[model samples]
Target chain A: GGIITQTPKFLIGQEGQKLTLKCQQNFNHDTMYWYRQDSGKGLRLIYYSITENDLQKGDLSEGYDASREKKSSFSLTVTSAQKNEMAVFLCASSIPFSNERLFFGHGTKLSVL
Target chain B: GDSVTQTEGLVTLTKGLPVMLNCTYQTTYSPFLFWYVQHLNEAPKLLLKSSTDNKRTEHQGFYATLHKSSSSFHLQKSSVQLSDSALYFCALRNMLSGSFNKLTFGAGTRLAVCP
Candidate 1:
């Protein structure tokens, strides 16, 4: 079985700072997604890529940017960190050929001071 | 807009007790429903899913039925275990898209199973 890896298990940033999170998957899946999770809240999709170099925005993509530069990797950037922001960023991949069951990364916990 | 709603924020149960977590949703398209479990400090994992109306789907002793008429996919288990304690999320996938299936999730319910 393949694994999904996310860099920087914990992140701390200052207000207005720009930060980035990276994800890599060995599953060789065709689709990748980025989601944000606030404490006690459900995940909100920020962006997703169906293929390399493709990007699609989700409802919560306004403050974020995503890149699918290669098939195995997808990255997300917080355009400008907001003060007192705290959330977890999760990355997932799936193969749509079967019913899509997403495999997720452990998540990056972000704390913006 | 497609969305999911989970009724309780926290549910505490004893081992071997019956369990149920209410999940309801709203969507304009035929929806594919799913239940995910997240252990502390771990990523959420798929627990159960249902695309066929009124059919029950199960995994790891947990089960749920997707009721299209009521827009509900309530999770249930006859016997709860300590391992079952975790955060549970209900999600929906928009089925109208040809290839891309976008998902929307509900605010999670925290399940605590004690001995």
Candidate 2:
């Protein structure tokens, strides 16, 4: 059994500030993903990596950057935070196949002032 | 482009009552449908998934049948409990796309089960 850990369960940032969130998974899964969840909205894919050093953009990649330096770690960066912005960022990992179930982290709640 | 739709934004029910949440989808290719439940402050967990048509799949007392003719996969439970309160999301996987990992999700339905 493995767990996906997301750092800084709660995040607060100022407008125009840059913030970074980190994720680590011990599942050794081949694929990792970042998703953003807003109130009343479904989770939107930000970025995903098929393997270490690989990056793929999703529907909501704009204003966000991701890194997959190692298979166990995937990180996301918000280039410029918007004032009063609030959302939860989730990290997930899955086996090599697409049909495989995804394991998710608790998520990082972000609030920008 | 593929999309999923969950009609109810909020559903309030009493304990012991039957539970049902509507879901519909649109896609050009064969679809894999999934139901995910997220408790307060918890990560969303897969409740059920099915790719076969007219076959019922169930998990944790919840069940859903994939109706290709109606393009629906509605989640239901025989009886509700307070513990059943959570946000439910319906998602679709586009098998035709090269990146099958990509999933399109519905807006989500929030269920509040009271005693």
Candidate 3:
């Protein structure tokens, strides 16, 4: 069995600060995703990496950046934190298209002060 | 573009009563729908999934019938339990890249089963 671990379960940042959240998975899945979750707004995809060093923009990608420098890790960065970006950010991974099930992390709850 | 819709923001039910959460989706290709349940601060986990049209899939006493005709895969359970209280999300599996599978999730429905 494998687990996806997200760093800094709770993140507090100052407005305009650049904040980063990291995710690591031992599942060795090729596809990794970063999703922002908000109350009544559901989960919106931020970025996804198909393999190492590959990054693809999602529906909500304007204010964020992502890196998949290693196959076992994917990280998301909030370019300039805003109060509106305060939400639960989740990281998920899965095998490419096969079965199409996602394994998600516990999520990082962010707050901008 | 692909999208999933879960109309109810919240559903409150008494224990032992039947429950249902509606899920609908839009996709250009054949749709793959999934139900994910999140309990409080825990991570969301897969509750059920279906790809074949008109077949009902069941798990952990919950079931959903995928109807391609109407683009729906509604989750249902005969009896609700307090343990069933959770936020439920419906997702659509989308093909975005040649090597990856992308999912579009609905806003989610919070089901509160009371005693």
Candidate 4:
């Protein structure tokens, strides 16, 4: 059973500041994804990578950037934090082409001040 | 546009009672439905998935069947336990709109089991 680890479980950033969240998976899955979850709302996709060094934007990728530096790691960056913004960013990994199952990280809670 | 809808915001039940969570979806492709469970401060875990219509899929005492005709995949358990109290999310997979490995999720249902 492989695990997905996300670092800096909680983050606080000032308005207009740039923040980055990191994720690592040991599942050796070929696809990785980043999603944002707001209170009382559904999870929204931000970005995804099918393979190393590949990046694809999702429906909510306007102010976010993603990178798959290696097969085991995926990272997301918030271009500019907004005041009073609070959400949880989740990282997930899955197999190639098949939507079989996604192993998810515990999520990073972000609070912008 | 692909989307999932879980109408119940919260469900409270006594231990040993039956459990049911409603999940509905809207998608253009053949639906690939899934149920995910999330404990407090923990990552969401996959509970069950079904792409075949009218067939029930079971896991860890929970079961759900994807009904394409009605666009619904509701989760159910014969009996509820305190351990089953958690957040449940219904999801649908979509790859048609130039998106790769993307999942559309429901708002989520919080199940609280009281002993």
Candidate 5:
């Protein structure tokens, strides 16, 4: 019955411009994650937080910044949009040590011109 | 380190046929494997997951069994329908690597069921 909401479902930015995506969840989950999805590459983690105001770098964290301003919200910023980058950014959340299932939002599709 | 492999890039099958998508993983720690399905223009959702070896987990008409001996969790469904067309991803949770909520996903397999 809970849902994860991602704002700006689609974004278009010029190369070298900064872009930010927002996510909000009402599941009262303790953990949140940001992943990048490409055509053939599947999904790759960029950042995740287990609690409010905490951030952990993932394998593909470079060139991206994440913030867990509060328990209900997590934000991700693309430091600089790459010309060749056109992918989807997904937001997910879960209750640690409880249910291993993660709830996902529709995702924000990013396109760099 | 943890890794997941899905060898098929695309699978084309007609409706009413049985389907199987290969998934294998590698990890030094205990493996928590998952299968996620993403329909067109929709979010990726958890189809099923399992950490118990040799036990089969089923959901929404799809089934998978975790085999620690071979380190594989293959997704299967009998008599696939047109709605079964989508992208499937196999993921691994490397709990021992300092994070219990992080997942490493494979390249993904796209299934297209035709009439």
Candidate 6:
């Protein structure tokens, strides 16, 4: 079985600062996704990529940017951190088919000061 | 607009008790329902999923039936154990969407099982 690895288990950033989170998967999956998890809000999609160099916005992509520079890696960037903004960002990968389940990384917890 | 709703925010129960978590959804297209479970500090994993209407699908002692008419896919288990305690999320896939990767998730329900 393959694993999905997300770097920086925790992050602390100042207001208006830019922060980046990284994800790498060894499943060789064709699709990758970024999701934001907030308390009481479950998980909201931020962006997804079908393959290398492809990006698609999701329901909650307003302040985030994603890049898929390689088939095994996907990255997300927070444009400007907001004070008191604390959330967990998750990275997931899946096969090309719709019926396949996603494999997710542990997550990166972000705290903005 | 498509959305999934999980009504229970928190559920506390003793071991060996029955457990049920409610999930409902709204979508304009054909739906594929899924249940995911997340242990503390761990990533959420797929617990079960169903696409056939009115048919029950199960995995790892958890079961859910997709009801097309009611837009509900409730997760249930007859007996609960301490290991069953985790955050549960309901998700929907819009089969009619252009991209197959689009998955809309509901607010999760947290379950605590104690001895």
Interface RMSD per candidate: 1.7, 1.1, 1.2, 1.2, 1.3, 0.9
Put down candidate 6 lDDT per residue, A22-95, tens digits, no spaces.
99999999999999999899999999999999999999999998899999999999999999999999999998
Misplaced by over 4 Å in model 4 are B95-100
Sort the predicted structures by DockQ, highest score first.
Answer: 6, 3, 5, 4, 2, 1
Clashing pairs for model 5 are none
lDDT of 5 by residue, A1-113 (tens): 89999999999999999999999999999899999999999899999999999999998999999999899999999999999789999999998754378899999999999
DockQ of each: 0.70, 0.72, 0.79, 0.77, 0.78, 0.84
The TM-score of predicted model 1 comes to: 0.97
The TM-scores of all predictions, comma-separated, are 0.97, 0.98, 0.96, 0.96, 0.97, 0.98
lDDT of 6 by residue, B1-115 (tens): 8999999999999999999999999998889888999999999999998899999888888899999999999999999999998999999998874756888999999999999
Docking level for model 5: medium
Prediction 4 TM-score vs. true: 0.96
> How accurate locally, in lDDT, is each candidate?
0.91, 0.93, 0.92, 0.92, 0.94, 0.94
- Write the residue-wise lDDT of candidate 4 on A1-113 in tens digits: 99999988999999999999999999999899999988779788899999999999988999998889899999999999999999999999999778688889999999999
lDDT per residue (tens digit) for residues A20-70 in model 3: 999999999999999999999999999999899999999999999999999
Candidate 5 lDDT at B14 equals: 96
RMSD of each: 1.2, 0.8, 1.4, 1.3, 1.1, 0.8
Backbone atom clashes (below 3 Å) for every candidate = 0, 0, 0, 0, 0, 0
Winning model by DockQ:
6
Candidate 5 per-residue lDDT over residues B52-80, each given as its tens digit: 99999999999999999999999999989
Task: Quote the positional error of residue A92 for candidate 6 in Å.
Answer: 0.2
How is the predicted docking of candidate 6 categorized under the CAPRI scheme? high
lDDT for each residue of candidate 3 in B1-115, tens digit (9 for 90 to 100): 7888899999999999999999999988777789999999999999998888899899999999999999999999999999999999999885444423778899999999889
Model 2: residue B30 alpha-carbon error in angstroms: 1.0
